[model samples]
Target: MKGSFSISVQNNTVKYAFSLKRNITIIQGDSATGKTTLVDLIREYEQNGTDSGISLSCEKKCRVLEGNDWNSHLSLLKNCIIFIDEGNRFVESKEFASEVKKSDNYFVIVTREGLENLPYSIEEIYGIHTSGKYSDLKQVYHEFYKIYGNFNLENKIQKLITEDSNSGFDFFNSVSQKKYICESAGCKSNIYKKLLESGSENVLAIVDGAAFGSQMNLVSELLEKRKNLSLFVPESFEWIILKSGVVKDVEKILEHPEDFADSTEFFSWEQFFTKLLTEKTKGTYLKYSKQKLNPNYLSDSIKNKILNLDLLAFLQNSVQ
Candidate 1:
């Protein structure tokens, strides 16, 4: 269940080949992008098998979950890759998020709207596009592409905006050292509003990419019109700590997060990393807490180690 799964589903007119590495994968894009068609193929195959004029090949079962009875349907499934097309109000509900956290199955949801209740990764958000590889040019080929890319931090930052007021903000606020203004957006949803009101020429938003999928589209659209803003999205603050080599025996986990991140136990990678940090630093001077960061972590030796990471190298230039 921790391993990745690749799926190949096709009919005479179209084909989709993609891999799902995490528990939650979101498929969204413009119209006629084969998002719905991908779900239809799975539903069709589920109801009629090979005779449905479709072929599906995957190690795990692929099925569509919808309707008001989705809760009941989900209860009976395990170790599956469930697909949910848009218009299902259940997807946006807390009940669905609750079930998803408890279920061992993976999910591939198609929606343009973000689900704030679900802590899906920004890296998992994808858009479908035709790969343009087809036989006789009649059969279309669709593939999944990442909707968002890593932030470019080449520009100097005049202000820093973090998604939360907790440990993450504390760390960044300490590091800023009045070199630039560091403020919290309170939550991911408020990041857009913070950007709207900011008067800085260059702004950097540091958010937990692990659970920021819901606010990405809005922030992305805002970025297009506002060249002054850029994003510094790590999976989470805990991920930054783990990636900093501050924690021992985390190199493997950091390298292959998918292998250790259990879907049912932790809703997002952020939770997984948080638990890892708390456990690894238990009873140590660097003991971890989401509510308040340990003062020891802010010491020069430890602080420099974290800032030295490639992801946070921009802080050095900004502070200078």
Candidate 2:
């Protein structure tokens, strides 16, 4: 039910590469940026045409969906990688974004319009920048982070008032708050017990994509009782956005003299930014935390799909 596709295009003047995600991922840019050309190269490769500029590798067959055929195609499709050109008109509507996330397939969508439901910013799109690799599975761990795993469920769940099912969650709740899985911890009687006790409201459980490799079966057992109990994105969208958005600002701010001259205690860029993030957001910061608690399940080549997944936009749009 899972696979990967990677294509790199290189010519005398340009070189670009990006991979697709398990759910929806977008690529939007001005014309002649090689958006359609990239698709054409994939098609040519599919047709067995020789294009020295395009190199592709895949675990399974890849198909590009046409606008007229999307709905019917999805109905018939089950597990596969699909490329939907925006010209096929799939990314233009809120409805299409809704339906696509609920499917069990991977997608690479090209369009200029932003789908608020998807976790892509204009900067993170495929063709936006020509140089970087799409998925980097480097493990980011910190000595300060105490490992958390199989422990007292009862103790983790008892600490607070029940949260309403319809209560919405954004990046803020994750920063410095504990919603209490159990104050004393819930017994392993059922993972969903706290969720059920809390009520039918939208309780979002977000984990790292790497967890899929190590403990997905355990996670799945919990889900069998209730599908809405948890969530897992490639990493955190907070990390993704920081890397994509604020880092630029940090670099720009660095251009002027004495931004950090006053602070002798902050030596590393990571330390400076961690301090800055805490200051800016009132300690609603993401730093020094490890990427995931579990071991990886996928090979180095295909893991990027999970690493780069935008679970934030996907869940916000998919959950009711």
Candidate 3:
């Protein structure tokens, strides 16, 4: 955990050789970069205890923490070389950063994005590269900052004003007007029933994509049977604004800064919303959304999906 070590592989397409001199090392690159493959080979070498080229200077056993299963190996995390691969969803988490900072273990994290609030120094990050001999492939200061870019970390402090839903009778006071909410979920009759409480009518109906597509039968039934009701998703509404040019850039409309701590150009929605709550809101600031999924994070193929959404017209019509 305190010294340098190297992984020297033979007859493999992964990292031919990589060395770590710090307590925390970050290996970041795009997908299919042979990141996980290297971790597997290292783990296999350690488990087999063969004369493989992996060299360890620490007393603790070497382990590869794969996926979300990294948490299961927590007990063995101390004073060892902890190699955590991407896709675990913990790479961008603050909790993981806090936990990692509290220990003396050495970490080799394979991720496409950088972690926030980590203890690692700037010299710790390296852009992993494949397709070279062990002599030519050893990683150096990759300056991931150039590849990913920088972001805004402006934290806003405000008074903690608390309010309760029961404290306001606004929704209840206007109850006789027949308030309605629409969501996307189809084919789940029980869900529809639950949403449509006795006096409330369709209290929880949804068009949730996660549920399934629209059921014409149920949609028509609800439409005919229920009056003074409406369903809308804020995201769909957002699409409307975008299609109409009411707000051209999603980042500007959402008021989420087109910045991220790591992928500077990728327009991080998480940091943006976090800014709104901690910076721009009144009352109790409720931060929403997570992950670094925005326009900048999309691949060219799937990037079109974000632009060619058919819901634009529907969103526009619903709003108007």
Candidate 4:
């Protein structure tokens, strides 16, 4: 039986020592940090067999595919190791994330950054680094170019973050406001007709809460039109507030929406244009207004909310 192998950085030497147990391992770091290489090494070892029972069951390991085909892959890899490369790409699908969380077997997620607020226990997080060099930079550029067919460095970096499983931003930054756009009346009528034809009582519809009154008003309108219908407002609203300097007074606004009723609803294009001046002068003023009254008290509330609600997951799930 082959055992675990170690490679030396100085000599590019490989040595087999002991075997690793079947556990979930997350390889995370910045781009070109050898995360993919490390996962490939682990995969190779599994295929070749180590000194111990840690062996690759190729028949059991399944690669996730796009679209509805995941069901077939899930059935095949149930209770087995599933390798998810660039796991962040699937963040748009809450159902997919839910399924992965529900899986009983080990999953080795290879990501550029760690998956934050995931339910599964992270057995290990390995940070891989590369000695930056001219040749190394050239190799990275060449590989990316071959894959994407373009060499715009900034665009490539953005794409890398999106593709890499473990890579994502931790802190919140509001760059854009999320406003729900209602479908045209014709489209809405078609949707309702389709739902009725299918014998479904409820259909998911997106509506601009701003055009209505508040989110509550939008919900009430939907209730009047369709029975049993449920509406999900994306958490992007919170990000907008945070990014736009509204978080400092979220509690106050939530408590007294009538006070800032007009300003508290959906952000307008006018607001976006003026966000810079507002974020600098107006934002600082609003932020300090609450802080000046009870500094430590508000800070404590924010912390408590984060811990209790798993704010990271809330933010991610809300936006996506």
Where does model 4 exceed 4 Å of error?
A: 1-25, 41-68, 113-117, 120-123, 129-320
Better of 3 and 4 by TM-score: 3
Winning model by lDDT: 1
Per-residue lDDT tens digits of candidate 4, residues 104-212?
Answer: 4454565554243332222234444344421111111112111122222222111111100110111121200132111222221232333233223223332212121
Candidate 4 matches the true fold with a TM-score of: 0.28
- Candidate 3 lDDT, tens digit per residue, 11-117? 44334566665556767656666766667766777676556654433344567776565555765566677788777787567767666655656677876554544
**lDDT at residue 107 of model 4 (Cα atoms):** 49
**Model 1 C-alpha RMSD to native:** 4.1
What number of backbone clashes does candidate 2 have, counting pairs of residues 3 or more apart or in separate chains? Answer: 21
**lDDT, model 4:** 0.33
Is 1 or 4 the stronger prediction by TM-score?
1
Question: lDDT value for candidate 1?
Answer: 0.84
lDDT of 2 by residue, 1-320 (tens): 33234545444444555554334445655786567766665666656644554556566556677766568767776666667766666566666656564666666777765444443322224444434333221121211022123222223332221121111122323221444331211222233355456554434443323112223334445545653354333332323334334333554543431234222232212334334534544433222222321122123332333234343333223311
Which scores greater on TM-score, model 1 or model 2? 1
Predicted candidate 4, C-alpha RMSD: 19.6
The total of clashing pairs for model 3 equals 13
TM-score of each: 0.91, 0.38, 0.38, 0.28
